[model samples]
Target: MRIAIIPARGGSKRIPRKNIKDFCGKPIIAYPIEAALNSGVVDKVIVSTDDEEIASIARQYGAETPFVRSSRLADDYTGTVAVIRDAILQLQQIGWTLTECACIYATTPLLNSERIAEAYQLLFDSHADFIFTCARFSFPIQRALLKTDQGGVIPFDPPSVPKRSQDLPPTFHDAGQLYWAAVETWMDPAKHIYSADSRMLLLPERLVQDIDTQEDWEHAELLYKVMQSLGQ
Candidate 1:
C-alpha cells in the first residue's frame, strides 16, 4: 500500500491560513491533494491537520481526514518526521497497511503528478531510503557576498572571488514540495531525508517557490499564472 500524508496545521504565523488560502482560484492545499490523487501512485491521500477548517476543506478537495492531529504534534516545534510517523502509526493501528509514503506539502501549488510519479519510480528502482524534489540555484553560490553592519559588502567565500562562475560547483535547494520514503524508513526517526543515501529529483527553478510570507505568496501566484499561460 502507498499513501500521501499532507501536514497542514492551522497555526500559520507567516501567511495567516496559508494552507487553505486562495491560489489561482482554489485553496492552495487543493493543488497537492489533486496532484497526489491524480498521480496513480498513492493508494490513498490523507490530510493530517489539527484545525477543523483545514480538515473540512481537505475532505472537500477529496482527501481523507481520518484523524485530527494532536495539539502536541500540531505545534510549531514539531518536526515533519514526527508528524508523518504519527500518521503512519495511526493508520497501522486502524489496520491500514502501508509500504511507501509521500509527504506532500500544502504550499506546493505548482506540483504535478508527473514529478510525483518520477520520484516514486526512482525510489523503487534505486531502492533508496528517500527521494524528494529540489531546484538548482540560479547563481553559483561560491562567489557569494555578505553585507556588513556598516553596509559594506565582503566575499562570503574569499577564495572563490577570482574564480569564474562556470568553474564553480553547482548547488541546489529544497523545492519544498514533496518527499517519498518507504514506510519503514519513515517510521524510523533516525533515518533522515537529507542523508547521502537519499536521492533528489531536480526541477526548474521557475516552477519552485516557498510561500512563507506575503511577498512569496504574490510571487508564487504570478509564477503560477505565467505557467498556466505558457501551457506548462
Candidate 2:
C-alpha cells in the first residue's frame, strides 16, 4: 500500500493550533488531505496527531486517524523522521502492508496534487531512496549578512562578499512541503534523505512559504488568495 502520513501535534508555540487553523477557508490541513487524495498516488491518507481536535478535523477532511500519536513521540524535541517512523511501524503492526510513503506537512495551504504526483514519479523513475520538494533561494545565500551583538552588520560568508551574486554557486533549500520515501528508507534511521541517492522536485519560489509567525501567516493568506483569484 502507498500511504501519506501527516504529523500534526497540537503543541504549537509560535502559532497556536497551526496545523488545523483556518488558512483561506477550510482548516489548513484540509489542503494536504485533498491534494493527497486527488493525486491518485496514495492508497491511504493517514494523520498522526495527539490532539483530538486535529484528529477530528483530519477525519472530516477525509483522512484516516488509525491511532492517536503517543505523547512520547509528540514532544517538541521529536523530529519529523521519528513521527513518520512511528506511523509506519504502527501500520505494520496492524497488518497493513506499506511500500512507499509520503510525509506531507499539514500546514502547507498551497500544496497541490500535481507536485505530489511529480515527487512520486521522480522517486519511482530515479529509484531514489527519497524525493522531496525544494526551491531556489531568491538571492545567493553565500552573500547573507548577520548582525553583531553591538548592532553592526557583518557578512556571514566573507569570501563571497567580494563575488557578484551570479558568480556564486546556485543553492536550493527544502520547500518544507512534502517528502516521499520508500518504506525501507523510513525503517533505516541511518539513511539521511538529503544524500545523493535522493532526488529533488524544484518548485518556484512563489509556491513556497514557511508559515511560522503571524506575519508569515498573513503573507501566505495573500498569496493563496491571489492564486485562487488566478484560478490556479
Candidate 3:
C-alpha cells in the first residue's frame, strides 16, 4: 500500500504552533494533507501529530490521525526519522503493512498534488526505493566563501577554480518538502533515504519553500497567493 505520512508536532519553537498557523486561509498543515489526498497516487494519508487541535484539523481535511504522536517523538530535538517510524509502527499494529510511503511535511505549503504524484511516478519508473524533492541553486556554489576571525575572506573550496554561473554544473539542495520511500527501507533505521538507491526530483525554486520562522511563513503565504493567482 502507498501511504503519505505528515509529521506535525505541537511544540514548534521557531514559529510557535506553526503547524496550525493560518496560511492563505487554512491551517498550514492542511495544505500537505489536502495535497496528499488529492494526489491520486497516495492510498492513505496519515498525520502524525501530538497536538489535539492539529489532529482535529487533519481529520477535517480527510487525513487519518491513527494515533497521537508520543511525547518523546514530539520533543523539539527529536528527528523526523523517529516520528515516521512511530507512525509506521502504529499502522502496523492496526494491520496496515505499507509497501511504499511518503513523508510530507506540514510546513511545505508550496507542494501541490501534481508534484506529489510525479514524485511517486518517478520512484516507480526508476524502480527506486526512495525519492525526495530538491531545488537547484541559482548561483554557482563553488564561488562561495567564508570569513575568517582575522577578517580575511577564505574560499570554501580553495582547490577548485571558480567557474561562470552558466558553466558550473547545476546543483540542488533538499527542498524539505516530501520524501517517498519503500516500507522496507523506512523500517531500517540505518537507511533513511531508502538505502543507497535513492533518486531526487528537481523542483523550481518558486515551488520549494521551507516555512520555519515568521519571515519564512509570510514569504510562503505571499508566494502561495501569487501562485494561486497565476493558476498554478
Candidate 4:
C-alpha cells in the first residue's frame, strides 16, 4: 500500500494558523490533500497534525487523520523526517502495510496532481531512497555577497568572484513541496533525505514558493492566482 503523510502542526509563529489558513478559495492544506487524492498514485492520504481543527479540515478535503500527532513532534524544532517517521509508525501500529510514502507540505498551494504523480513515477523507476522537488537558483549563488559589520560588502566565494556566471555550475534549492520515499526508507531514521541516494524533481521558480511569513503567503496567493488565470 502507498500513503501520503501531511505534517501540519498548529504552532505556526510566523503566520498564525498557517496550516489551515484560507488560500485562494479553500484552506491552504486543502490543495495538497486534494492533489494527493487526485493523483491516484497513493492508496491513502493522511494528515498528521496536533490541531483538532486541522484534522477536521483535512478530513473535509478527503484526507484521513487516523491518529493525532504527538506534541513532541509538533514543535518548530522537530524535523520533517521525524514527523513522517512517527506517522508511518502510527500507521504500522494500526495494521497498515505501507509500501511507499510521500510527505506533502500543507502550505504548498501551487502543488498539482501531475507533479505528485511524476515524482512517484521517478521514485519507482530510479529505485532511489527518496525523491523530492527542487528549483534552480535564479542568480549564480557562487557570486553571492555578504554584508560586513561595517556595512562593507564582501564576496562569499572569493575564488568565484572572477569567474563568469555562465561558467559556474548551476545550484538548486528545496522547493519545500513534496518528498517521496519507500516505506522502509522512511522508517529508517538515519536515512536522510539530502543523501546522494535521493533524487530530485526540478520545478520552475514560478511554481515554487515557501510560505513562511505573511509576505510569502501573499506572494504565493498572487502566484497561484496568476497560474490559474493562465490555465497552468
Candidate 5:
C-alpha cells in the first residue's frame, strides 16, 4: 500500500514548534497533510511527531497519528530516517504493511497535491527506487571559491579552466522539500530517503524552499504570496 509519512519532531531549536507554526494563516504542518490527503496517490497519510499539539493538528487535518514518536527519536540529533523507520514499524505492528512510502516534510508549504501525484507516477513509470524534488543552481557551482591561506579566494575546481558563469554547465541541489522511496530501500541502513538509484525531479526554485530557520520561513512566505498572486 502507498503511504505518506510526515516527520515532525517537537524539539526544534531553530524555530520553536516550527512544524506547527503559523504559515499563511494556517499551521505549517497542515500544508503537507492536506497535500497528501488530496494527492490521491497514497492510501494513507500519517504524521510521525512527538508533540501533542502537532499530533492533534495532524488529526484535525485528516492525518493518522497511530503512535507518538519516541523521545529518543524526537531529540535534536535524531535523523529523520530513524523517525520514519519507527513510524513504519508502528504501522506494521498495527497490521499495516506499507509497500511504498513518501517521507514528506511538514515545513514544505509549497508542496501541492499535483506535485505529489506526479512524483509518485514518475517513480512508478520509471521503475525508480526513489524520487525527490530538486532545484537547479542559478549560478555556476563549478566557479565556486574557497578561502586561501592568505585569506584570498581560490577556485574550488582548479582543474577546470576559468570560464564565465554563462559558459558553465548547469548544476542542481537537493531542495530538501520532500522525498519518496520504496519502503524496503528507505528502511535499509545503507540506503536513505534518496536511494542510490534515486531520481531527482526538477522543481522551480520558488517552490523548493525548505523552511529550517526564521529567515527561510520568511522567504517562503514571500514566495508563497508571489505564487498566489501569479495564480500559479
Candidate 6:
C-alpha cells in the first residue's frame, strides 16, 4: 500500500506554530493532508507530529496519527529523510504494510491533489528510488552575482560573465513540497535523494514557495491570493 506521511514538529522558531498557522482561512497543514486524501493514488494518509495539537488538527482533516513522533527525530538538526524513515518504521510496527510512500510537507498550502497524483504515477512509470517536485530558476545560475565584503558586486562564475543568458543551461531547485519514494529506498541510509537514481517532477514557479520567515509568509499569502483569484 502507498501512504502519504506528513511530519510536522512543534517548537518552530521562525514562525511559531507554523504547521497549524492559518493560511487562507485554514491551517497550513490541512492542505497536504487534504491533497493526499484526495489524490486517489495513496491508500492511506498519516501525520507524524510530536505535538498533540498538530495530531488533533491532522485527524480533523482525515489523516491518521498512528504514533507521536519522538523528540529526537523532531529536533531542528534532524533532516526530513530521518522523519520519514521513522514514520515508516512506526507504521510498520503498528501492523501497517506500506510498499511506497510520499513525504508531503505540512506547510505547503499551494500543493494540489493533481500534482500529488502525478508524482505518484511518475514514481511507478519511471521506477525511480525517489521522485520529488522541482522548479527552474528564474535566471541562469551561471551568471549569478555575489556581494563582496567591501560592498562590491562580483560574478560568482567570472569565466561565464560574457556568456549570453540563452547559452547557459537551465537549472532547477527542489520545491520542498512533496517527495515519493519506495519503502526500501527510504529505509536505506546510503540512498541519496538527489542522486541520479532519483527523478524530479517539474512544477511551475508560480506554485512553489519556501516560507521560512515572516516576510516569506506574507509573500506566500499574496501569491496564494493571486493564484486563487485566477482560479489556479
Clashes of each: 0, 0, 0, 0, 0, 0
lDDT of 1 by residue, 1-232 (tens): 9999999999999889999999989999999999999999988999999999999999998999888899999888999989999999999999998999999999998888989999999999988999999999998888789999999999999999899888898898889899999999998868999999999999998889888989999999999999889988
Candidate 3: residue pairs that collide: none
Candidate 4, overall lDDT? 0.94
Off by over 4 Å in 1: none
- TM-scores of the candidates are 0.96, 0.97, 0.95, 0.98, 0.93, 0.96
Q: How many clashes does the backbone of model 6 have?
A: 0
Error of model 2, residue 219, in angstroms: 1.0
Q: Candidate 4: where is the Cα deviation over 4 Å?
A: none
Q: Write one digit per residue (lDDT tens) for candidate 5, span 83-139.
A: 888998999999997898998999988988899999999988887777989999987
lDDT of 2 by residue, 1-232 (tens): 9999999999999999899888878999999999999998999899999999999999998999999899999888999999999999999999999999999999888889988999999999999889999999888999899999999999999999999888999999999999999999988978888998888899988799999999999999998998889987
What TM-score does prediction 2 earn? 0.97
The C-alpha stretches of model 6 lying farther than 4 A from their native spots are none
Give the top-scoring candidate (lDDT): 4
Candidate 3 residue lDDT tens string, 1-232? 8999999888888888889888889998889998998999999899998889999998998899989898888886888877888899999999997899999999888999999999999988998868999888986778789999999999987755555567767777889999998887788866757346889999988997787678888888899999999999
TM-score of 3: 0.95
Taking all chains together, the TM-score of candidate 4 against the true structure is 0.98
Q: Which residue pairs clash in candidate 6?
A: none
- C-alpha lDDT (0 to 100) for residue 4 of candidate 5: 96
> Better model by TM-score, 1 or 5?
1
For candidate 6, the TM-score is: 0.96
Deviation in Å, model 6, residue 77 alpha carbon: 0.4
Top TM-score model: 4
Candidate 3 vs 5: which has more TM-score: 3
What lDDT does each candidate get?
Answer: 0.93, 0.93, 0.87, 0.94, 0.87, 0.92
Error of 5 at 223 (Å): 0.8
